[model samples]
Target: MTFSFEQPPDKLTWYHLGPLLDAEAGRLKYNPEQYTVHGVSNNAVACCWAGLLVDGDGGLVLTDLGRSMLASWKASPVGQRWLAEQAALDEEMSDPAAPSLPAPQPEPQRADQLGLFGAAS
Candidate 1:
């Protein structure tokens, strides 16, 4: 299974909650065709590992902890900020102007971001 968002925001895990909230609002569908059978299965299993959802007769069902946590988070300022940041990231991976490529003489390369998580690519 993959951690959809390898890096969480504000250490509050808004990425995980966003999906649960979507599920609560009936926007998240468990249709395997939409996200492949393994994708759907992997996501549900990952959510279960996060303790925010569980396997149900129909599909993955959000847990009580997930709901309560989302509610509590929304009531706090930090949580609000996190949500805003998450919204931005979800909206676009890159925005505004980007730096021009280095001149013919390039700079040293940086290590793979995923390397930090033991999943180098």
Candidate 2:
């Protein structure tokens, strides 16, 4: 079965299979031997591999094949509309020039016009 962000697998194994087995139901209970059997170098390698799958926007964007599988799922029309509205709201919120409460202006100062700092005048 294809994996996507929308419907991710319960137990995704890559480097170390120990954690993956632990997460899965009816799997051998947290055995360290799973990693050795899988030929995984270390737990850190597994974590790094998982981290690479994450996108810069923090949303888990899948590969072309994954996206194609996700597109097959029938989403509710109302849910799709709500998602669109939320995206629009997010765009407006992130705009730099969005209006805010008026700020008070500070009195302007001239460096050379100060009495002690000024020449004779």
Candidate 3:
């Protein structure tokens, strides 16, 4: 089926994607039109149209477009924040000595400000 990425019904989130991701990653068998996320059921057609999945002789497979889209979503500001939080949790689980937080990213200076409190030069 054909679908456009210009505007999707939902903004993809990390939540409710475990099944689909697992299927794509080969962790689970693809069972076409038999997955749900956040109480909403997903079908192969919808996924294929969204570029998140493709139909193959075997079953369904994740496409490069889907992978890239997911990566892009995860790299967004909000996504980055989530990543930091997950990293913190993972650190706690794997090694207590590791830093609990990600390095702070400096905020961009306002156009009116120069260095610190100095006026724009």
Candidate 4:
């Protein structure tokens, strides 16, 4: 019925966009962009316009609607799938043991007969 900063959420809103997110964006912070989970980007401004967040003492805090949306997202099966996938992606991205992307190849500097130029010079 009530939300408290001290209590952990049912599902962390901050990490993988789930785990890390819960620790980062889910809490009240000194930064001004906590509401949108990122700094003053389009989504940040849009969230304010959408009434999902508002200016608080030091930064943006979630409005009632925002909290409800987060609650619903966490409760849904899609959210679970997305969270799991995101967590895996994050792990893969950071894992030194995971395969690294192929090194970029040098591109041709000149245009071809078809007038197509290489993606990079």
By TM-score, who's the top model here? Answer: 4
- Of 2 and 3, which scores higher on lDDT? 3
Q: Model 3, 20: alpha-carbon shift in Å?
A: 5.5
Give the range where candidate 2 is weakest over 10 consecutive residues by summed lDDT.
52-61
lDDT of 4 at 82: 80
RMSD of each predicted structure: 11.4, 16.0, 15.1, 8.9
lDDT tens digits, residue span 33-114, model 2: 5555433334423432443122223222333432333333215464466558868999989998988668875445644346
Which lDDT tens digits does candidate 4 get at residues 1-121? 3233332334424332322233237454344344354444444444555555565655456767666767678678988888799899998899998888898865565324335653655
lDDT of 2 at 28: 24
**lDDT of candidate 3 over 1-121, digit per residue (tens):** 6355544435666442553465556654444455444122354446665667665555566677666666776778987887699788877889967666787865666533546577645
Q: Which stretches of candidate 3 lie over 4 Å from their true place?
A: 1-10, 19-49, 55-60, 96-121
Predicted candidate 1: what Cα RMSD to the true structure? 11.4
- State the local distance difference test value for candidate 3: 0.59
Cα shift from native, residue 93, model 2 (Å): 1.6
Clashes of 1: 0
Residue 94's lDDT in candidate 2: 92
Model 3: weakest 10-residue lDDT segment is 36-45
What shift in Å separates residue 1 of candidate 3 from its native position after superposition?
Answer: 8.3
What are the runs in model 4 whose C-alpha is more than 4 Å off?
1-39, 108-121
- Clashes by residue pair, model 2: none
